[model samples]
Target chain A: MNSVIHEKYTVAQDDFANAGKASSHIKEHLKEIGVDPQVLRRIAVACYESEINLIIHAYGGDINMDVFDDGSIQLVFKDKGPGIDDIEKAMTPGFSTASEKARSMGFGAGMGLPNIKRVSDEFDIQSSPEGTTITLLFRESK
Target chain B: MKLHELFNELNWDNLTPDVSLDKDVEGVYCGDLLSWVMGNGLPNQVWITVQGHMNIIAVAGLREFSCIVIADNASIEDTVLQKATEEGIPVFASHLPVFESAKLLIEKGV
Candidate 1:
């Protein structure tokens, strides 16, 4: 099946007030489209973690979601400059350089990327001084 | 157990009165880290946390948590409560700490 739906959402840096709005809207859209519950949950987690990462770390970013007729999902998260210095280090759980404000909001536990990678069936990442991009894929069935 | 039943059993204050309380709680997850909870919290689990903020409501909704128990009597801002109610996530306040709140849920076989 071919891709049936495409959506794009912009995320602002340090926009804690509206942090999860994009992810929530994506989840609702997937649910309405009758995506598998388990796959939907994984997509929700990955999408939300990506959104929070954009808000907490990036200067700003865009989240693009594509849903295929077979129920598979593709999420691409792209952020502006000031990208990750060490992808390996940032991938390590419990390693974080989040600011004090993010910590006070009960975030910055350093588990966002790892968790997103764990739930995603296929994950690809590329980072440089220009920006960072993470692409994640979730299959409807194992 | 159902959320209303647990709320009554714990005698906690209902912060989001407009939200429904008939949801079933299958488990208990106690964590204050929003990312950790978002990644690990299971559906229908009642989350016990000391951090009562607007983001907490978002996490609860994303994770499909049954409800949130703000343990240790944490003061939840009016805006946070309003958000929770608007999102249809029930919020409860408990005098017991996080561990104690989890213990009670365990005792109840949640």
Candidate 2:
């Protein structure tokens, strides 16, 4: 939570059938709130990556979007799933654990997490056996 | 062709026609996978797939697709339908497989 607007989205897992719904809504809401277009696109892209990660990699999760008084956005996605064993390997550009069906659906490209980090001004990912939490921050003007 | 006309030809719901339906649709691409569609689809191409979700609509929006046809007689959830309305992305449903519908739209020069 921050001084600016905050919205929380509940993400469902393996619900491959309904994934990406929340990310789309959040992006639309950001647009309505007058967020900048380039920043909006970056946010939209990151939101989608993180949201899909929740669906494909975890059982379930929650996304928290925080707008700070500093004209920055913080997107936090937390999921209940098996934690990553090697952060370095996961950070590689082309590594993935996505299922065959997920691959057929056009995901598991190993670009999801990397893209999220690339677009954000600050990105942090912490994983444990219990769950994984990802925090992404984007500066609106920088 | 006006998208609604295409709908009439298919005998399906109005789905989604951009506010500018009079504009001609350039081409079509059909796939349920995100990677292939992103890599292969051209602008203004109609995409037909069995995947029914809001992500489909979002991809259409992100890529500026002409319209999305849901094949295999899949119906869109209300949330996705609402997102379509907001994004001005047309949506459709058909009983044909993705490839078959792609063929149908191609025959129509869609």
Candidate 3:
């Protein structure tokens, strides 16, 4: 199905203050569209964790939410920063390289990526020295 | 119980009542970690934490929390208070520690 709307949000490194704004926006949009509350919460958590990762790990990134006519929502995050060296290692729970500052903020629990994967119905990630991109998909319950 | 009833019963310092006090209290959660709170918190729960950053309001908003109680008399900036008002999530303060408040809320059947 084709996307009905596409929303773009840019996240900057070390912008802890505004880390979840994009996720909040996406959640609000989904709510306004009358998405199921449980599904909305799942999306909100995944989007928030993804957004926070972009802020804490990536130098900078853009989060895009694509809403399709068939009630599926896809979130894509692309960051221009030092990409992850190992996907499998990063996916392991309790594995993190976040700084002390990020940890003190109640983040860097090493659960961000795994949590996102847990909530998302479909997840994809790709990275290189130059940048990284992560895509998360959620399908509406029948 | 509604947030206002709980606040009055507990004798908590009302930092701001601009947000709705009629919101129901589902349960209580205590933590300073923003991400953990966001991931685990449920709607209408009274979030007890020492952190007073504006993101607290944002997290409460996302999770649809009834209100926020800053334990141990943790000070919150005016900007955070303002944001709480904007988000319609009441912000309160307690001289007691988070554990004490949690116990009290549980006793009251939160």
Candidate 4:
């Protein structure tokens, strides 16, 4: 089946007040479209973690969501600059570079990227001094 | 059990009166780490935490948690309460600590 929905959301760096707005909106939209509850939960976790990463770590970023007719969802997160130094270490749980402000808000447990990968069926990431991009795929059956 | 039943039994302060407490409490998850809870907290579970901030509401809403119980008498800012109300997630204040709160819920067969 073809893609039924495509949406783009821009996130600003250190925008604590508006953090999670994009992911929340995406969850609501997917829910209203009658996405399966379990699959919706996975998407929610992955999307939210990605959103937080953009706000806390990236200069700024955009989250692009594509929902297909076959109940598969793809999310692409692209950030501006100051990319990760080591993807392998970043992928490890309990390894974080989040600021103290983010930790005070009950985040920065070093679980964001690992959790995103845990819930995603297909995950790919690339980083450099220019920026970082993370693509995630979630299918209802898988 | 439902959220209203647990709230009444625990005698906690209802911070968001406009929101409904009729949702089912399928389980209980006690965590202060927003990211940890985001990944581990189950949907419809009553989330118990001491971290009372606007971001907690976002986590609850995203995880589809039934309600939030701010344990240990943690002070919640008006902004956080307002956002929880706006998000339609019931927020409650508990005098009990996190452990006790979770224990009570387990005893109640939540």
Report how far residue A127 has shifted in candidate 4, in Å: 0.5
Q: Which parts of model 2 have CA positions greater than 4 angstroms off?
A: B1-54, B62-66, B69-87, B91-110
Top candidate when judged by lDDT against the true structure: 4
Kindly provide the TM-score of model 1 when superposed on the true structure, using C-alpha atoms.
Answer: 0.97
Residue lDDT tens for model 1, A1-142: 6888999999999999898999999999999988888988998889999999999999989999998777788999999968999999999999898999999989899999999999999999999989999999999775
Off by over 4 Å in 4: none
Q: Give the Å error, residue A126, model 3.
A: 1.0
The CAPRI classification for model 2 reads as acceptable
* Tens digits of per-residue lDDT for model 4, A80-114: 97999999999999999999999998888999999
- Of 1 and 4, the candidate ahead on lDDT is 4
iRMSD of prediction 1:
0.7
The global C-alpha lDDT for each of the candidates, from Candidate 1 onward, is: 0.91, 0.76, 0.87, 0.92
lDDT per residue as tens, model 2, B42-88: 66777888777656876777555788888888767888778788778
Q: Could you give the candidate ranking by lDDT, starting with the highest?
A: 4, 1, 3, 2
Best DockQ among the predictions, by candidate number = 4
Full ranking by DockQ: 4, 1, 3, 2
| DockQ comparisons of all candidates to the true complex | 0.85, 0.25, 0.60, 0.86
| Residue A49 error, candidate 2, Å | 1.2
Q: Give stretches of model 1 more than 4 Å off.
A: none
Scanning candidate 2 chain A in windows of ten residues, the lowest lDDT window is A15-24
Residue range A1-142, candidate 3, lDDT tens digits: 9999999999999897786788888999899999999899889888988888898999989999999998899999999979999999999887889899887767787888888898889999999989999999998762
Write out the backbone clash pairs for model 4: none
**Reference-based lDDT, residue A126, model 4:** 95
